[model samples]
Target: MSPSASFSDVVRDRRAVRSFLDKAVPDDVLRAVLDEAQLAPSNSNTQPWIVHIARGTARDRLSEALLRADDEERYSLDFPYDGSAYEGAYARRRQDQAKALLDALGVSRDDEAGRRLAARRNLEFFGAPQVALLCVPGFAGARITADAGMYAQTFLLSLAARGLGGVAQTTIGFYADTVREALGLPDDHKLLFSMSFGYPDKRWTAQTPRTYRASLEESVHFHE
Candidate 1:
């Protein structure tokens, strides 16, 4: 976000930028964003988030390994994620989000191959020049991991405020072993997700549709 952009502007400007340019983000900008995100509130200030930003050669190598692992179905998720758990309106929103994205890319619901190819791009980091691996201790448990979500959002917002963008992907978490090996992180440091970030590819950003959020009326409950 620019100097004139308000907090609201920054919030509204943020989106899951699927495609990014080949250009790498400068080191100073990366540091500045991390600094801002560090201020995010955490449970008891435990700050369980351990972020590893991979750039240049490391980023390239990790992306390659992820693609290979994905092909072999060498899944190694630290946590079980069942999207089927979302029911009613939640499920519909998830479906709508997928449809909107595919529609924007002109991939039909019946185009199984196309959909698969699109999904595979996640492993490629959508051509991003850098990716951040968000992790926590293997035994952090559900509550501590939940605090990491706050950290993740702050990181994402910081990116948007700087005219950068990223997509937080649980898909990358599926290849936890590959990521751990690439970073030489211990098995105890569990992978939660990743955000492939950099300057968004303007061609895709300008045309790709963004997902809608729920209205407060339906999403929140009034106590008063």
Candidate 2:
């Protein structure tokens, strides 16, 4: 992060970084960020988030496995996920977000091949140097899931604080089995999500749009 960045600056600047350079994050810096994220609050002080970070050769093999599993139409999701269940503003936002990405990359909606390739990039971690898979034990239910979300946000902010960037990948949970098998994780672990992070490639980062948030009135309410 910039030496002059305030808390609000970090919050405002943090976004899903879709592209990254080929450089690896130094170990000390990575540890400092994670250590800060560890302070995130959890339900009843029980931190249920299990983070598994992959880099170097291991990350490459995991990506290959994910792509193969996707090709075979095989999936073992710990939790269900589909973009279609939402409606109203939520649905509209999702559509707009998709279009923004496609447009930013100069991919036309009519180009099926190009669209597919663009979508496939998620599996490749957008060429990021590292990925973190967040998992919880099988027994963690809905309430703990909320705690996990908080943990993830803290992690993202921590990355931003360190001048790094990351995007949380829900699709990674769709390939939970492949990741678990490839990484030798316990069979009982439930993969909630994953993320790809690194120092962004400025060339590509310049091409993508920042994610926008809803207006305060649309999401917040108070009564006296």
- Best candidate, TM-score: 2
Question: After superposition, which runs of candidate 2 have C-alpha atoms over 4 Å from their true positions?
Answer: 1-4
TM-score of 1: 0.96
lDDT tens digits by residue: candidate 2, 1-224: 33347889999888898899999999988888888879999989999989999999999999999999989999999998888898999999999998999999899999999998988888999999899999987898998899999989999988887788899989888999999999999988899989899997777777788768899999999999
Candidate 1 local accuracy as lDDT? 0.89
Q: Report the poorest 10 consecutive residues by lDDT, candidate 1.
A: 1-10
lDDT of 2 at 213: 87
Least well predicted 10-residue stretch by lDDT in candidate 2: 1-10
lDDT of 2 at 126: 91
Tens digit per residue, CA lDDT, model 1, 118-161: 99999889999999999988779888888899889998998988
